[model samples]
Target chain A: MRTVEAMLVAEVVARLCEEANFVLEENIHSAFQRGFEEEISPYGKEVFAQLLSNAAIAAKNRLPICQDTGIVVVFIDLGQDVQVTGGSLYGAITEGVRDAYQRGYLRKSVVNDPIERTNTKDNTPPVIHCRIVDGDRIKISLMPKSAGSENMSTAKMVNPSKGWEVIKEFVVDTVERAGPNPCPPLVVGVGIGGTLEKAALISKEALFRPVGHRHPEEIKAHMEDELLDAVNKLGIGPMGRGGRITVLDVHIETYPTHMASMAVAVNLLCCAARYKTAEI
Target chain B: MVIKRVNTPLTDEVVQTLAAGDHVALSGKIYTVSDAAHKKLVQYLGYGRKLPVDLSNQVIYYAVATPTPPGRILGSAGPTTAERMDDYTPALLGQGVKGVIAKGYRKAEVLQAMRHHRAVYFGATCGIATLLSMYIKKVRLAAYPQLGAEAIYEYTAVDLPLVVNNDIHGGDLQREGRIAYAITQGN
Candidate 1:
């Protein structure tokens, strides 16, 4: 069995926290250029320019790309043959997040309770999804979900009987209704099939995929392309100023489901698209 | 395509002159609110109590800024989703607030209130936080200090960028742009 030290995991998490917030994913960074080039609306063009510069300034100065540093969500893939030494895996992750937020000057957004709403002061106890997989390494993928776009994410139990058209309408409608609220141009992640919660999980997982990268599954990938075309045709544009490129990309993930259950979820990521993965 | 320079506290003439699709470089005093503090302000009026900070003729930006880090006057700052404040909006506008800065659309009632109050709604692009921080010169707690970020804070901004969204004559930038672009596909 391979042993991974708890302290090392903490350090990686802290680094990932800072890097994800400070440096946007490269695909998202490039999408801004494409957004600038393709945007037809004069106002849309201006938004693209600002978004491009916003990233440059954030990266150069080690400043957060967006002020809403966001609620941190992580997915941990633990190899079945690996053992975490020195501290609990959960403890290490929480410590890493707490240190990163304070040291990096990112906002602490987690509230202690849903109703009482007291600030945790430290962005700790991140939403973590753990999986046991083959291999001797531990992998961590992180996405700091901004409230604006996160608030706009939606899920519905769709009917496969009605087919792609039904799923297409729901996803497109969600983006249309979100309009300029969550900050467009958007990266839309769609999960079809699986149970309700599973659908939700994979949809967010789909976001970590690089922008403009097609799905490996040919059928699902085609759906992604069609959805992207339909959403762009909405002309919500960059910053919703109305243009041809409202959505930067649409990513879809599918899973086999129970006979009657066909759950669909759409997770929206703003242009910043801060995602980082680390292996230990 | 014309960009205007707007200073505050805004007068009726300034508010009336603005329209959708116009860009603006806004400077001067502004107040910021998170949803929590906004609820308190609206509740104060609901109970017929006086607010600690008067919003009359003043613009209120719907946002919560990050805490200042080393070597910065203020942390990265930008607009939050505006719809969360929709419940508190008409009350603020009715109380004579003239300008609102945020990203996204306001609800139907909020839109009506904008027209009735002759107020202006403006949007700053989302995710441009660090860039926008360059324009904020100063910040201080204005009221409800106990609420932390939920407390109202006053800001001094110079040439902060914004686009007019909803204007007094009933011009709406997002709606107009959305309709124009989507309709082109016969969609």
Candidate 2:
């Protein structure tokens, strides 16, 4: 059995927080570079350039790419065979997050309440989602979700009669209505066919996929492609100033759903898709 | 390049000279605050109490800064979304606040305040917190230390680059820039 200690876990979490906050993942960086070349509009291209420069400056300077450093979200794949030998996992994660936020100089954007807002300093107590996987390795994916794009995320329950056309329309309309608000040249993550909450979960999970990768399943892959094509057609462009590359990518992750209904969730990622992963 | 360090309650001469797309750096004294601090500041003012810091001729950057490790002057600090502060901006502007720096778009009312007050709203590049931190030469809290990142800290910067988004003469670079780029792109 693999044993994880509190101090070690805290250290891991701290590093994860710093990397996630400061650096743009290599895949995302490549995607932006590719987008710059593929973008037809001069405006679109310029926006892409600025974005790329911004990412580089952020990483080199070790600062957040956006003011909304985002809510710290951790997806932990813990091995069932592994044992945590040190302090509490939750406590360690929080402590690590605190240390990283302070030491790394990342913003502490988390608030205590949604309505009657109060801040929880240090961006502590990350939204931790742990899944016990089959192997001995523990994989941790840290995502800092900004509110601009996150606010536009939507989930809905569709009747069984509504077919793929409805799904396409719903997804397209969501992107169109979102316009430049989600910071165009966005990544659309779609979660189809699951219970309400599960669908939402899968939608966020889909965002973890590296840009340009498609679903392994043929049908879903085709659907994602179609969605991507349709979203770009909206011409939202970069920064909503209008352009051809409204969407940089579309990712879909699905789960089995109840016979009575199909639930769909759309999670939008702005151009600055910042995330990092680590294993221990 | 000439660098200017001026206090806020900005005058027409300062704001009129600024244009969108000009790469200018800010210096001198500025304060860091975000939504949480905004709320607290509003509340304090609502009760007819003096603010912990004076607003005259001062610029406020909408930011939630991470705390510095031991002995550091400050931590990674960057601008937050401007739209969130639309409500408080007018009030702050009315109270002799001169400049606001943030990322994202702002509403018309906020622009109107800038127009009326001869103030300028500057848009800093988002996600450039790391690069931006190098500009901060000094940092000290003015108020609300309990608010952590939301606390108001006086940041004396040198060449903190930003674009003038909304200026005193009702010029809004974001809207104009977006429109021009959209038309040029034919989208």
Candidate 3:
């Protein structure tokens, strides 16, 4: 059995939080570049140019790309064969998130309660999802989800008879309703054929995939392409200013569901598309 | 389609000439307020109580900036969604707030208030906080210190960039821009 120090996990989480906030991932950067080139509207092109420069400025200055530094969503794939030492895994991870937000000067946007709405002061208790795998290696992925795009995410349980066409329509309609609100050009993640909650989880997990990477399944990959084309055709553009490149990518993940119900969830990520992964 | 460089404490005359789709680079002093601060401001106004800061002819930026790091005037400062603050916007406009810098659409009531008050709504590109922070030279807490990041901050900005989405004459860039580029896909 391998022993992974909780301190090490904390250190990695801290670095991931800071790095993810400071740097725009290369895949997202390249996607933005492509969107910049393909954008037909002069205004859209200008918006993309500004976004590119923003990424550079954030990196050079070691600053957050956006003020809403976002609620940290950490996905952990822990090896069953590995045991955590020094501290509880959950405590260490939360500590890392707290230190990152404070030390890195990222915004503490999380509140203690949804209704009372008191600031948590230090961003803590990150939404952590952990899965135990067979191997002796652990993988940690962090996605900082900003409210602008997150507030626009939706999930629905559709009648199974509504089929794929309706699911496609729902995704497009969600983007359309989002308009400039979700900060298009967007990265859209669609989760289909799961339980209601599972659909939401997978839809969010879908965002961690590198932009433009396709699902292994040919049919799912084709649907991603079709959704990408359809969303772009909406002409919401960069910053929703109007152009041909409204969506940078569309990702879909699916699971088996009960025959009577089809659950779909759409997770919209803004152009920043900030995330990072580390494995040990 | 013209780009205009404007100074803050935006005047009625300047706002009148502006139209949707006009790009603006705004300099001078502006105040930052988000949902919490807006709620307070509107509540004070509703009760006919004195506001902590004067609003006449001031530009209000809808932002909740991150904490300033060492030796920095401000941290990442970008627009939050304007729609969330729609309920309180009309009251602020009624108090002579001249313009707002934010992203996303405004409700009809907010637009109507802009038309009535001759204020403009400027759309700052979302998720570009670090870039926008460069324009902010100074920042100070104006009110609601308990609110932390959501506190009202008075910011001195230099050529902060934005696009006019809604102008005094009922021009709506968001609506117009989407309509211009929207393609009809067959069923």
Winner of 2 and 3 under lDDT:
3
Record all residue pairs in model 1 with backbone atoms less than 3 Å apart, i.e. clashing: none
Candidate 2 runs further than 4 Å off: A1-10, A36-68, A86-92, A102-105, A111-122, A172-185, A233-246, B1-9, B14-28, B50-52, B56-58, B69-72, B167-187
What are the per-residue Cα lDDT tens digits for candidate 3 across B87-169? Answer: 88888988899999999878888899888998999999988899999998888889999877888999998888889998889
The RMSD (Cα, Å) of candidate 1 is 1.2
Off by over 4 Å in 3: none
Error of 2 at A49 (Å): 4.4
Winner of 1 and 2 under DockQ? 1
Give the DockQ of candidate 3.
0.83
Give per-residue CA lDDT, model 2, range B1-187, as digits (tens). 3434444446667777876544567878899877878888888888998888888768899887655645667666666667888888877876778788886667777788777887787876554555577789998878998876677888988878776667676666655554444332244
Better of 1 and 2 by TM-score: 1
Looking at candidate 1 chain B, the ten consecutive residues that score lowest on lDDT are B178-187
Query: What's the i-RMS of each model?
Result: 1.2, 4.1, 0.8
Top candidate on DockQ is 3
The window of 10 residues in a row where model 3 chain A has the poorest summed lDDT is: A235-244
Candidate 3 CAPRI level: high
Question: List-wise, what DockQ does each model earn?
Answer: 0.78, 0.27, 0.83
